[model samples]
Target: MSNSSPTAARLSTLDRGLPVWIGLAMILGLGIGRLMPGLGDVLESFTIGGISVPIAAGLLLMMYPVLAKVRYDRLDTVTRDRKLLIASLALNWLVGPAFMFALAWLFLPDHPEFRTGLIIIGLARCIAMVVIWNDLALGDREATAVLVALNSLFQVVAFAGLGWFYLDLLPTWLGLSATGLDVSPAAIALNVLVFLGVPLAAGYLTRRVGERRRGRDWYENRFLPRIGPFALYGLLFTVVILTALQGEAITSQPLDVARIAIPLLAYFSLMWAGSFVLGHALGLNYPRTTALAFTAAGNNFELAIAVSIATFGVSSGQALAGVVGPLIEVPVLVGLVYVSLWARRFFTDSSTATSVAVPVTSKDSS
Candidate 1:
């Protein structure tokens, strides 16, 4: 008889050693990029509304399974959590960008292009991969879905204005060199629609139909476990494609990439820790706190990269900086998932810990 623990038994081999899989995927991507430099161009040639179709496909695939796992009927519970809602808004919009602005200038003041790029990244709050991180850490899936949707809406409405504020106005005020970011609301909206909206709709529809057809128990127990692993597969695929596309850029400019990475590393750690502590103080339970921290810490790197390339050209230092965002972010956030889980022990197990945080099962075997 097998002596494997129940938790280990529940998790697939892919999920059990996710970090190893992700690392290998990254290495494979770099190899592909270095060996066949033109592959990125070939894949990117087929783009819709200025977004790459292949990348979009991976993102949709990555998002759909996680979103489908969300108990949408329970979102009203998340929405009513005023502490979580207000904290998420404040941390994402007000604190996140400002902190990145400070870090960019502090770390790479001499490299104006990289500095601007870092600030651009900061201005773009996360709308995509935070879902994966939140789920892995056993966060409140319903709350995460709601928060991601909210950030998507905010990104479309406020991205350009914030870009101007951080990239232009604030820099000018600080006696720093300023550059204009020529982004339109329509373009931003298109990104949100494709990256977030499509997958969201698909996931929602999937859950609704599956539940209707097979009942909630079968939909959650049978359907969900089957699809859950695909989310990680999509993540691995996206990582490979992304790193492959940026392989030459990363390998060629090791020093510059390192320089760009330092502040990013600092930024991710700071935002996540700060948000986690704040959530605890706000009396949020572990699941909601995990959701809050990840959503706060993650960035919309896709939008940042697009904006950088559009504004400064693909070969420019700003674009390199943007490329480095996800490269640094992926590994760091993966590590933070462990940190969040370990920290979960600190929270009181009682539902009376706060009015905002509803009771959630901490374990997600799927």
Candidate 2:
């Protein structure tokens, strides 16, 4: 299901111009919202029977790229970096969320709106931005692929549980379900597969065909190169429309965003620092260090958004908070990528091997 090395490189280009594309998506979303409000509303809805399928389009639309790069073969190779993977899980699901909860509880309490937003951002892990951040951090794709897949699979359960539990901490105005662990596991699981699995299968299949037909070179040279940028634009446009839709809400509460930004900045710095210390202590080489540090720092927002919309209403502040998570995540992780690269010189190969070398492909990761 995964692409060859060339295909990986080809697919990666979409992520480079992320900021620009995100800006364009904002503009496009605005235009769409204004020119075709009715259609826009429809596009926003994910109806089933009597139910409103909120953010359905956003969830389904953004998965194109996530699915495109999915590699079925990744499971076999995941073992090469077991320590790094375990560290990522510990940090992302456990330590990172814990920090986010504590930070939200600390900073944004006076402003309920921003406090709620921070909680949503904290609980939701990631989808899109992590891959880009991983690359920027000089992480191995094999490692990223394994972690990404596992993260996606976990979001269904984590989203509702974390959202309900944490939002319950807020004042009663939020109306988050504090009652119990009430969301059905099966339903959430189905939605995850629909959003994640379908695209994953499609990406796997596409890679399968491309690899067989013209060979890996053709895939890298042709199709992947073409789709990569378009997909980035697609994801960007999705965010823009989302922002345009929420433009009024966001602008009105500039201070709220300002308030939330601090803990988010703090969260990034803390996670990065933790990873860097751990990477060196563990004796990871440059590539492994990059992978280790990034795995701790990045998130999976898309899955969180989907779960948020499912739990919180479409227009609910909780859902909006979830959307805002990537605003902080993308650029910060990109910065960390270069930071990891610079830190590479500090470690000797012997240190990397003796320190970081647990088991593996035996060479420095690119």
Candidate 3:
């Protein structure tokens, strides 16, 4: 037998510890804000077009890697598995957002800013980290890749409309205060263009140019591995900066953070469970089910945070809630990976049983 150590496996897992890094970044950012409050203000002051330039850059960096990895060519083939696509889209756009809206109201009825922040998160589907979670759970990576690509594109159009409807129009109908809500579709579209559209176009261009120059093999094997870590670095840096900016609020109202966290925790769990059950009931196989579950469960907190800061001020409770979103999401999704893996056997076994129960044809005996 070949000598193979478990240490390698452990090390490999450690490399994927994004949550730990994000947590550390938050702590460091909080400390920096406490110690050098002036510096945080200066960083926040570097704004252009109603958005922080530094945070915008970080968001772009965080998004580009994942977007570049998408095989746009596979989009045509996604329709071949229409069930998977339909299920994912339904949960992501309809069930997932509506469920979170209810939870936010139920859990945070008094905190409209926090509720709005959560609503923004709900409107934006997962684009980046769902891929990681899908990989960890041995889900269908190709399906997820296609889904994410579609989601990224769809978000540019859908997010703004959904944000207006849920955050502004619906709230007004329900007699909720729509104060400070920038429900202007034009403004929302501009934010989407800045935060998502630019990065998406850049990622596509990078992939195309890199493939043309260095060849697909080199682009995938060499170029991708080298640049992929930048996304994580960007994410951590954004978390730190955002946390630092809001450190005073976080410090003063710890319970407020916990209150914001409650609905988020519920949203993640409910999304995952609902998607999994729906996929299983629809007769989706294990891999497809896992893909749906993970995708629906994960939120594009980066986009949500950027939009929150742009629409609501950086120091607004909305932005603070956006920051808290990933803090709850990263660890919860990581834990769900393990749960998904354990649940995989049950799905597989059910599929096996179904196959066995099918009758054999008499022509086979002849």
By TM-score, the best candidate is 1
Considering lDDT, which of the candidate structures 2 and 3 is the better prediction for this target? 3
**lDDT digits (tens) for residues 1-366 of candidate 3:** 122532123123333465577679888988887777676568867876556788778777766765666555655655698899988888888888888888888898888888888888898788766765665465665577677766776786788778777877877899876643454445545556776677678877988999999898787666766666666676777777777777777777889999999999999988898889888899888767888899899988767776787788777788889878887887788788767756765675423221111011111111
Per-candidate RMSD, Å: 3.5, 7.2, 8.6
TM-score (C-alpha) between model 2 and the true structure: 0.73
lDDT of 1 by residue, 158-262 (tens): 999999999899989999888788998999999999888998999899989999999987876677767777788888888898888778888877899899999
Error of 1 at 280 (Å): 0.3
Give the Cα-based TM-score of candidate 3 against the true structure.
Answer: 0.78
Clashing residue pairs for model 3: none
Q: What is each predicted model's overall lDDT from 0 to 1?
A: 0.84, 0.57, 0.72
Candidate 2, 80-112: lDDT as tens digits: 767777777777788877788778768866655
On lDDT, the leading prediction is 1
